[model samples]
Target: MIGLANGCSATWHANRIFFLTVAAYALAVVFAASHWDIPLNLRIYSRPFLLFGFGVTVILFVVIATRVMLERPARLFPTLGRRLRGYDVVNRLIVGVPVALTLPVFFSLFTSMKNGLSRIVPFYADTTIVALDRAIHGGQDAWRVLHPVLGAGPLTFALNFLYNVWFAVMFVVLFCVTFSTGDERLRSRYLVAFVLTCVLLGNAAATVFASVGPAFVMPFYGNDTFFPLMNYLQATNAVYPVWAVDTQRMLLAYAALDGPRPGSGISAFPSIHVAVAMLNAIYLWRFSSLLRWLSVAFLIAIELGSVHLAWHYAVDGYASMLATPVIWIFAGWLSGLRRWPVAATAVS
Candidate 1:
């Protein structure tokens, strides 16, 4: 127990923002479980935790291997040997491994609890969100407008691929930011923003809004308003095989099960996918012009894909894009507080 406390303390000192975020997530889970009678399922998070662990381990190995390869042949093994013996490497492993492990657990709980609480509230904002979407798109679905230009076989496939790749992209960004011995300020900023976005925007805002998005509207609300959109997507899936369609179906089916399943959680007021993409883009803005532009393009693509794929309403993406910047700014301020001697002492 003392060793465990020490380990946790070290982790907190290394990444206070992440630890705090996880604590907040835990409290939220407890509150939800007590109030809503939501069961906490540790089993659901096991597979995803394993997958993320494996992926991050491979990525770290590749990065280290690439660095070793870049060295002169004469110095390669020596350099690798030195790095392996170095205090920095050992310290990073000691600190980073636990963080990497805990993040997925926190995320799983956040998602699961959010999904359970969403159902408990029993107030879905699908109609209101769709109305907002139509209002913004001049009384027409955004997909209808975008379908003509981007609904082609190749573009649809590409968009679906890109949309689905958001998870991988997010993981890469997260792994790099969390574990890489890069610029401390940049890393802290990104980490804080990410936590704030997931907890404050992704879960909290989603709970307040309580929406099921475009994809689950029919099943949840019996509203056929999005049937035309769904039918169009089914046709596209027939031709090009969009992954979002299948994922949406799977999530809906899981949601229909008896109780809170491990990976089953759904709410779609402000699209967390777009919000995270936008958050990353905002942070990447300071890196370089080319990266900034690429981030912006990716953000736009995600926004479009979120709508066109029928996973979200147009307004869902809009709200996410708008809210993300504010959350980023707030996170920045919170990160800045870490610089204070008092804050540093507290973490220590």
Candidate 2:
């Protein structure tokens, strides 16, 4: 019992330390970039909004840690013996390691590791959007022909806007499910496998497309809401008290990255937001009918939002839809180890 508690406590300490470090580095890079006016190897690191977001993130982290820390495993499951020892280690690791190690590495990879993008896109254009941009913005009549049915009006337009909410909803659900169900081995396994998939999908989409998104590529498409907020974030510096009321802050938190301009001229393809919501759907499909319908709704909104808002070229959505199933299958394959456990521990 004493050894398990010490091990779990150590893991928790390591994770909290890493999280604080990542938050600090991200803010330091953003602030240094903004004030010094020097090119920080990564483009996103220099913006004022990024700096502000980092500060806010630090505060939120502390609050969440304080709230959740009290319920730490040793307190929750008092009884322990050799039989339950293995699970105690695995459970603590799952809860602590993903928070401490995985998330920081995942975010760090994108902010610095530009080479990952280079490695994958060697066969394709440096960024996949060049040909795509021309095809849609070109004098092609096929886009116009296809536009009418996909365009947002009173009927599907509200549905179109809802995709924005779904992605956030999905992420919050995963965070809550994994963090709250700490004692159940089966539940924890599902949470780990699914959150890992969501995080991977997010990074992969960012690497594959390297897009700021249509909200930035060409903001006039009516969904200028996402673009303007991002534009505010990329060009600004310093967090203001009133800035908390600013819509752009929420937009940036939800969005993986922002573009150079407030609107028009950023990565605008493969709608990763859509991809994430879809991934959530795949995980929840078997468990909840509510999620299954939400997933279908999410995809439809994604298809319409991308085209109607002119945020993504039609091909981007099509590509995302095609790749989603493949990514889901791959993530599932990693989690196939559950039938036979490497080790299992029960709590009394």
Candidate 3:
């Protein structure tokens, strides 16, 4: 451990808080699995490892292509060789492997935690949140309010497509941050903030609030409060692929299983999807004006998607957007990160 630590970057050391956080969360996951007799499968690691490998390949290809284009075409092989230097490769792997490995474990455990939530605390918050959603949206379900503009089948389908885009966008950010060679302090803070957002808003807060969103309430609790919205989504899906409909059905199936499954967790309140989008926007805001505005636009789409797609109430997005900045600030403080002025260009 000391030998490995000796060659680590300051940025790597700065991620100590994030490392410790995941370690602690892993412990909790283990305890929960043992107590519940849930199988902790090693195979769960394979998916993330494969994804990490693919991302690394893509990054390397992009770098090599850009360098060869800018410098000399003949240096392509040499560039690849130089880029694959054993020490640099090993060093980055040392720094990045754990970061890459965290997702599968984090998500698998998150699924377990969310699945176990209702067992520990019955979901009694949905009906109440339904009423609260109406009151806050001027006595109409938030989806109804959105129907005037977004009610069209093609638009609804487009929003659903963008909502699914969140996963890819999120992975890209994570991959960049893990492999980033610039601004270690900033990277550390963002990493810490990202983990905190998942644990706080996604896990702890979700379990406390414990409400299935509009899509699942009817299936889970026999409440048709959101049936009309679900019907509309289903109708749109029939014409164009509103993938959320199928994903929601899959979640319900996973929720029924006795053991934890990959990508099985589901919660409505304090939308993690929106919170993550907000975090990405805030972090990238300092990089460049283009990234700032693009991320901000994505954030808005995610909020609107959450409602129109029937995955969350308006208040879920509202609460998530509100709490994310607080978590980001707290994470910054925890990491002792200082504010840096915006940069005109992003680091390569």
Candidate 4:
């Protein structure tokens, strides 16, 4: 611990705090890694994270060493030297959050890849898909009208991504971060929560529910509307298999031609898009009541788009959406336990 002129460094000797934090973080990383189950990708991301962490630690030590050398003892102890130490813990916390979140989901998924879990029914869950199919029975007509409009033009296709709602939500989150207190410790915590939740939703989507969207699988009409967008993504990830699969699904969807495409019998149930969007809505509410409403609206649009576009069954959207709000509430609760000192100071 460092000895300050008049008092203890408020953040010095914070090692114990981070030890607990890192332990919790390690557990989450394990969960994520097992869940994502992708080894190659995990390695690809970890290297940069490690490098960044190392660079930050080095800078922190340099600063602390300089402080210890120059800082004088209190007037009462003029003959004594001031010592600077234990500040590196802060740097560790700074980078630990994301590492904990991403690595675990990736590992957890990779771990489960063998049970044929990667292709399981949520990727392949049966009963859930059946329930989704049932909902499609009554809503098909209502959806047909909405679906065509969504796939009709670039404007509609852009709207299909729920850009308006998300764009609004992003600003709300940004503003909250901007105005948060001087302390970022807790803000970073919640930020990590959101990042992990979304990553989990995406990784799960990739592994469990790889549905070729309505635009691709349904033969209702020519998917020229959204196919172009899907095609662009395909071109974007021509290198990565994960991306390649997404693009192919879109092409398969374009080929399905809009009338009645075969939903990837293997994928469907639990719409990831809804899960993620709704989660964003839930977390954004951490900022303001206005954000809550925006999230709610986005939730609704994402749900509607899922079915109208036939990328997901109504049941799947409902299930995925449910988890989102639940996860958001949890994330908010945990974040609430701590406050951003910097954020609070700034706001004050």
TM-scores, all models, native as reference:
0.88, 0.49, 0.88, 0.47
Task: Give the per-residue lDDT digits (tens) of candidate 1, residues 1-348.
Answer: 976666565566667766776787788678877887876765566677678868777876677868778775677777777766663665566567876777767777776776686656775677787787789888998888898898787788898899988988898888767775546656677787887788877778888888887788888888888898788778888888888888888888877665556546887878888999998898889888998998899999998888888888888888888998998888777766657553443222
What ranges in model 3 sit over 4 Å off? 1-5, 8-12, 32-45, 73-76, 79-91, 337-348
What value of lDDT does candidate 1 attain over all alpha carbons?
0.77
Which tens-of-lDDT digit does each residue in 1-348 have in candidate 4? 223311122322211233344356446545644565422223433554356445655765576666655665344232222322133343444333433434433433333332222333333343345445656666333354454455444434444446334534543453343224345554444454544454455445445655444444423333353454455434434432222235345645533342212111223445655776765665566668986887788777777656654455566777776666666556556555444353232211
Ranking under TM-score, best-scoring first? 1, 3, 2, 4
Candidate with the greatest lDDT versus the true structure? 3
What is the TM-score of candidate 2? 0.49
Cα RMSD (Å) between model 3 and the true structure? 5.0
lDDT of 3 at 147: 94
- What is the full ranking by lDDT, best candidate first? 3, 1, 4, 2
Clashing pairs in 1: none
lDDT of 2 by residue, 127-182 (tens): 34635545665744223444566432343345444745664575465444433334
Per model, state how many residue pairs clash: 0, 5, 0, 48
Which has the greatest TM-score? 1
Model 3 reaches what TM-score against the true structure? 0.88
